[model samples]
Structures are given as structure tokens and as C-alpha cells.
Target: MLTTEIREAFLPYCLPDITDEEVNEVVQSLKSGWLAKGPRTIEFEKKFAEYVGAEHAVAMNSCTAALHIALLSANIGPGDEVITTPMTFAASANTIIHVGAVPVFADIDPETGCIDPDEIAKKVTPRTKAIIPVHYSGHSCDLDAIYEIADKHGLFVSEDAAHAIYTRYKGRMIGDNPKGAVSYSFYATKNLSTGEGGMLVTNNEEIANRARVLITHGMSRNAWNRYAKGGSWKYDIEEPGYKYNMFDIQASLGLIQLDRLEEMQQRRAQIADRYNRAFSELAAVKVPTVSEGTTTHSWHLYVLRVNPAELRIDRDQLIEELKERNVGTSVHFIPVHLMTAYSKKFGYKKGDFPNAEAWFENIVSLPLYPSMTDDDVDYVISSVQDIVHKFGK
Candidate 1:
């Protein structure tokens, strides 16, 4: 039994870990006067590339931009099929649509909530051109298996590492020495925050070069610095491209956040450990699972699954119960295939992917962030325990 009762105030599901240092850094960028993809953004990209052991990194306004540029740079177009899991944010599939390619939905490995490599293999055809495997909740996909399939079929692999900035696969960082391209999110909710930004990393220089041009309205090389010192006014337009560059202000937050990633991650891990310990004993709850291929999980979202048969309350009722206790919660995803856009466009129905649909019905992401205090962690754990005890069948 929990000794502490529910708190008086509502605990938010997410809040970026920010401090005076971050505020001061943003002020510094403002004072510097050059805000559009300036030195700071460049420096952050260089540091991020090195951090992930990639040869090149391009900053973008969002992960959607990075994912789109990744496909565009690779020449994946109409008539091409890009396989990705339906168990992710719509951005994963939306990017494929934006690239003029068909987004092929693959079911996930229910245990890890990542795209099943076997399912990916089954989706391959002569038209299949790429695979955008998302690392769900910072848990890595089966890279070895996915890559083997990619290699056999001569397909491009664009990893959607939106939740995997700190994730590792078989002891290698998710972006380290990538077989293709990897896109990472620096959204406010991520472990590393840039307010709203993303990075596309690759070891291939040609793709990197093209990605650079593709991000800034297709202006010729070095035009990003035309406004700075020793700059030239005249530049050529190579092709039509999107305005997706990250400004210095966001990079200012990114630089400091990147430096503090280890500290933030430690706190998140402690909170996760507490959740795991507390929830493992509950017959009605299943704690998030880290796949064997995942050497390190980024701990981006602490998702818990409730076995409906063991609980009198369904997942929605569980959320309401927690809400009544002043605890906030969220669902990681509601399978992309089931969304109206995909359903109406692609004829996807609920039963199309049973595993993903089942996983969706079972999950509720709890509050887990670096700023959460020990008391907050305990309260969340106790709150969950209380719910289970009250609702368990």
C-alpha cells in the first residue's frame, strides 16, 4: 500500500528541463544579431555529427523536414514504396507521402513496439525503395535484421530516430556509422531540446551535400553565409527546395542542451528505474520492454501497458483514474494506419495490423522527465499502484 496520497496539484506529462543557462544562451543568440542558420547552428551540427559518429549533419526546422530531405536526397520518388511501421507519429508516414512515394505500413514487434523486420521483409517488392524504421520510445529496432533485408534487396534505410538521440544498437550509437541516413528530433519533449528542431546525419558526402542545398530554398553552396562577414551577394538557385534551416536561437538552446544531455539522461533513467521496479510487481501492468538489440534506450517516454483482462478499467479509464488523482498521462501513439487520412486514402482498417492495434489499446505514457523530482516520481508510482489495486480484477 502507498503511504502517500495523490498530490493536490496536477503533474504534467512533460516539461523540458531548462535552467538559467539555457535562458542566457538564448539571450546570447539574440544579442549576436545573426539568427538564421548562423555559426551556432553550424557548430551544433558539427558537434551533433561528432557525438553520433556521423560524417555530416544538417540541421532542419523539424524531423519531418529531415525525413523528407533524406528521401529526396536519395531520389526516392513516385512509384517507389517506403516501408515504415504504423505504430509511430504521422510524420513518419507523412514524410514518405511528401516525397512522392507510397508509404507502406509494416506491423510492429509488439514486445518492443518497433517495426518488425520480418514484417518489413514481407512488404518488400520490386517497387520497394526504402525503409524508415522508427525507434519507438528510444528502444532501437532490430537493425541487424533490418539491415540484412536492406542489403539483400538493395534498398535505402532512413532511420527515424525521433525518440533515439541517446539510443544505441548493439553497442553502437543509433546514428554512428549509419548504413544510410538517420533523422533525429530535438522537439521540446525529447531528451535533447532545441525548442523545435531536428538533424539529418549521414556518412555519404554526396547525400550530405545535396541535403544542404535541399534545405535552404535550393540556393547554391555557401549562400547560408552570404549575410555574414566576407560574404558574397550573388548566388545561383540550383533547384526548388524547402526553407527548412534551423536558426541560431534554436541552436543556442541545442548547444547547451547537448552538453547537458548526460545529466538529464541520468535523472530520466532514475525515474524510469523507479517506475520499472514499482510496476513490475503489478499483475495488471506491463512495463516498457527494451529489446535485446537495444544496447541503450534513450528513455524518451516511459510507456506502460495495462492488461485489460487483469484490470477492470480499460486504457482510457486508466487515464481518467490517473487524471482524477492529479496525475497527467499520454498515449505514445494511436497507430498511424488507423488515422482517417491513411484509412480513407489507403483503405487501411483497424484489423489490418492486429499487433499495433493491440499495443495502442494497452498503452499510457506516464510522466518521466529529468525535471521530475523524487517525490514526483514516487507519487506517480504510488498513484499507479493505487489505481491497480482499485481496478485490478
Candidate 2:
């Protein structure tokens, strides 16, 4: 039982661990005069590719853009069906619709909240063109099973690695393999912070090359080269494309963030370990799991599942109680299928995905950013323990 008083200050669910290094890099990029898709962006791309052991990495304005362009480059449009999990942010499925494809929602594994390969197999059809598996909460989906299913159907797999910067699957990084395109987010709340930016990584030269062209309005060359000395004024629009290019300003932050990634990630891991140890003995709380020796979870979000049957209060009540105690909490998602946009378009309702719906009701993401102090971690843990004990049935 926790005896400490409720915290005096509020602790947000997540915060970017920015420092003087990130600020200095951004300032340097600003002073360089060439901000939009310049040298820093190029260097960021290279460093990011090397970090993930990917053959190529293309920087974009957002992870949504990365997914859209990745699907577009793979020729997934019109009559295609892209299979993904509903237990994710809207961007995962929205990108499928954006590329004129249908978003097929597969149920998730109740334990890990990842799309079940079995469900994915059942959803496959003649029109199925690709699979976009989100590394939900930085826990890598079962790559062996997902890839095996994709192989059997001859489908493309574009990974929504938005939450998985440091996640490893079967001893290899998510994007390290040549099987498909993997998109990573460097959003303000992501494991790797860049304010707002994303990267699309793949081993396929064709996909990488096409993605580059598609991000810059389908131009033959990027803006930096077009405006540089000895550059030709003439350019050609190869295809109608969107303005998804990431700027040097964002890349500057990304470079420094990438450099400090391991250090920050270690801090996140330490906090997660503390949470796991503290919560393990609580019957009403279920901590997130990892695959032991086979994979490395990035610990981006420390989501806890409340056993409603064992509690006097429900998940929503738990969140409210935590907030009342000055600890911020959030649901990783509301299950994309249940959202107004997807529900209306796909004709989905509450019971459509029972696992996701049930999981959605109980899961809560606690404050788990690298910037959090040990006291912050303790406050969150003690608060949760206190609430559960007070409300336990």
C-alpha cells in the first residue's frame, strides 16, 4: 500500500527529452539559410538509414505521408485491399484509403494488442495487395508469422513502425530486412523526437527511388539540387505528387535525437523496469509483456491493462482517479475502427472487433517518457497502486 500523499504537480503522459544539443542543432540549421530539404535533411536520412541497418531512408513531413507514399509506390490503389489492425492510430488505415485502397481491419492479439497473423490470414482475398502491421506501442508484431502469411499470399508488407524506433524482431531491427517498406515516426511524442517528421526505410532500391520522387511533387530532382549552384533551372514533373518533403530544420533535430537515442532509450527502459516490478504484484493490473529473448521492446508507452472484474471501478474511473491525483494518463488509441470516420465508412460497430473493443476499454498509457525523473516514476507507480488498492473489489 502506498502511503505517500497525492503529487502536488501534474505529470503528463509523455514529454520529449530535448536538451541543448537538439536546440543547438536546430539553430545551426536555421542559420544555414537553406532550410527546406537541404544538407541536414540529407544527412539525417543517411544517418537514420545506417542506424536501422536499412539500405535507404527517405525523410518525410509525417509518418502519415510515409505510409501514403509507401503504399502509392507499391501500386496499392483502387481495387486493392490493405490489411491492418484497428487497434492503432487512424493514420495506419487512413493512408490505405488515401491511396484509393480499402482498409481491412484484422483483430489483434489480446495480450500484446498486435494484429493476429491468424486474423490477417482470414482477411486475405483476391484483391488483397499489402499488409501494414503497426508495431503497436513499440512492441514488434510477430514478424515470423506476419511474414510467413505475406509470403504465402505473395503480398507486400509495409510496416507502420511509428512506435518502434529501437524495437527488434527475431534479433533484427524492424526495417533491416528487404521484405518491405517500413515507416518510422519522429513526432513530438515518439521514442525518437524531431518535433514533426518521419522516415520511410526499405532495402528495395526501386521503392526508395520512387518514394523520393513522390515526396517532392514527383519532380525529377529535389529542391536543394535544383536551386544549388551549377543547377539547371529546367525540371520535369514525373507524376502528380504531394508536398511531403521533410525540412532541414526538422532533420537537424532528428540527427541529434538519433545520436542521443540509445541514452534516452536506456532511461525509458529503466523507468519501464521500475513500473513492471512495482505493478507485477497488483492483481488488478497487467503490465505489458515482451517476447523474452527473441525481441526488444522500445518501451515507448507503458500501457497497463486493468482487470475490470477485480476492481470496484472501471478503466475510465481509474484514469479519472489518476488524473485527480495529478498523474496524466491516455489511451494509446480508441481503436481506429470505432472512430467516426472509419466506423461510418467501413460500417463497423462496437462488437465488430471484440478483442480490440475489450482491450480498448481497459488499457491506459502511463507517463513513461525519458525526461521523467525517478520521483516522477515513483509518483505514477504509487498513485496507480493506491488507486487499485482503494478500488479493488
Candidate 3:
């Protein structure tokens, strides 16, 4: 049934799935009074490490911080190059620059929107020190092929797993047994959020220890509780670093969210399944394709690529129609290489990465979150199909 009704209330594109338990956790942290970056944050780090099967985890203020630390901990600095996809957020590339390294752009696998390993190989050079393959929209990149390239070139691998916390590569969790480091986002819209936080997980002790110091204003160990009862007040700055440590309040939320991750993820999966069934066979639409080796997808963003060639309306127009129909939408990315800063700095321009450019042109991210009800999901589906029927060639 094509729902001819427009919702009275406008559905948001995304929302944080916070429960009363999360609220109580924050209240408990506030009541505890030791709220800087204390017990709760440390506990979150430990629990997160265990959940992802990583030997160590360092919670940070943002995924960008983790990415910067990943490069810095490995001594990737000036005169070095880090290859990453232009199909991701600017932070993925910007973090490489933050570490005083050049960010080399690689085109994406058009079908999957993930960085192409072959393109990554093509971009590698004598100065290439690392590769930051983004797990685009919760579909794990071809880690096996990517790591093989890194091994051949003796390059470090810092995975941009902002969208892949629950994604599985070859039946292993995205953060499990990381090659170098895996950075995850905890932004309000992420699958597992702490309002605004991130975590860096790694099996390498050197990298993990370095990240802890780097994110805490370079304060030495044993100084974290310097203000506590019978605690030492002395510390040393190992090196100049950033103030990017996660706070207790955020971790308060994280602790509760982690406990409910599976429950929330099930809802996201159901919504994604609804979307796939609705659009996969539609003539003028293309649903996201879970790439090979991705044994499980996190269903972070249900990105639907509209075929403008077969539709009377294009991507932008579809967005407008959806808005009028009381459904909100977003775009996954605008391709980092095409952004003003990248173009002005690297002399990059459109036509540089044709596949990414084409993918961007036809894509619109529909709302996919645990908070949405079944009625909401069906309404969104009907709205999209109605538009297709009205506008299709």
C-alpha cells in the first residue's frame, strides 16, 4: 500500500537511543563527584576493551583524537604519507594532516563505498607510512586485502572504524585483533554512543600505552589519581600531546549503552531489513550492498542510491519530497577530495574520483535507528516507494 498520508510529526533523520537506565547512570556519575576522567571513564575503557576483544582500549573525546594519536603513536610524522578513502568524513583525512603527514586519496569500491585496496596500492609510495581504510557505513572493508598490501609495503594500518563497531570481517568483530589500531565513534548518532566520545582499541601495548598518555595532556601514568586520597602528586610529560580524554559523564552513558548494544542493534537490523526489501528490487533505486567478507553489518546508515537516469526526480529532489512527506534524510558524504580545503591544498577537483563522485550524486541516507517504531519504518518505506511510483520513467 502506498501511504498517501503525510505524517503530522516530522521524523528526524537520526536520534540517540538513550534509555532511563542511561539517564540513571549519568545521575550516578554526578552523585559520585569524582567526575573529571576518573573511575567511570577507566571502567568504560576496560569494558570496551573486553567487548571488542582488544588487549587495550583508550577512550577519547572524539574519534578524530584517536586517529591522530594512532598516527603519532606509530611515529608517522612530517614527510610521511597516509593513504585513505576520499569517500569518508574529512576527519579521516584531516587526522593524517594533524599528525603532520600528507593524506593520500584513494578512490572507493563503487558498489560498497569502501576504499579500494587496489586503489590503495596504487596510491602507495616510498613515503607512504600508513593506510586508514574506513569501514564505510558499517560494512567492513576488505581487511584481508588491505592488510596484505600494508604487509607488503611495511605500512601501518589504522582502521577508521567509526561506522563498524558491530561489523564483522571474516566472522571476527571489527575491533577484534586489530592490525594496528581501530578508532570508533561515540557521537550521539552512532550505533553505540556516549553523547560525544570515542575509543581507540589495539592489541599492541606500545600503541595503546602511547595513546593513553597522548590523550591525557601527556601526563605520565600513576598521575591520573594524583588528587585522590594518599595519591602521588608528581607526574612527567612524556611529550607534547592533546587534551582529548573522555570524561566520566560520557562514560556513564557508555557503560549503559554497551550493556544494551545487542538489543539496539537488533532494531537497527530490522529497520535495515525493511529498507532492503522495499528498495532492492525497485527499478529506480539501489540499496546498500554488504561487501564480501563482511559476515555481519552494523546497519549504521541505510543509504539508498536513487537512479536519477530512470527517475523523473534526482537525489536532491527526492530529499525534498521526503521532507514534504514528513520524513528526514541525509547524505553519507560529499567526498573529502572534493571539499574546498582539500581541493585548495592538494589541487584536487571533481572528475578526480569519478566513481565516488557518481556515488555521491545519487545517494540519500534514510533514517535507520533503534528508536523508530514499526509503523514509522513502514511509513518511511511507503513514502520512498510512493515517490518512486510518481516519479519513475
Going through the candidates in the order shown, the clash numbers are: 0, 0, 0
State the TM-score for model 3: 0.98
Q: Would you list the C-alpha lDDT of every candidate in the order shown?
A: 0.93, 0.91, 0.92
Which is better, 1 or 3, measured by lDDT? 1
Q: What is the TM-score of each candidate against the true structure?
A: 0.98, 0.98, 0.98
Q: Which residue pairs overlap in candidate 3's backbone?
A: none
lDDT of 3 by residue, 230-287 (tens): 7888888988778999999999999999999999999999999988988987999999
lDDT of 2: 0.91
Off by over 4 Å in 1: 1-4
Residue 353 local lDDT, model 1:
96
Candidate 2 ranges with C-alpha deviation above 4 Å? 292-294
| lDDT top scorer | 1
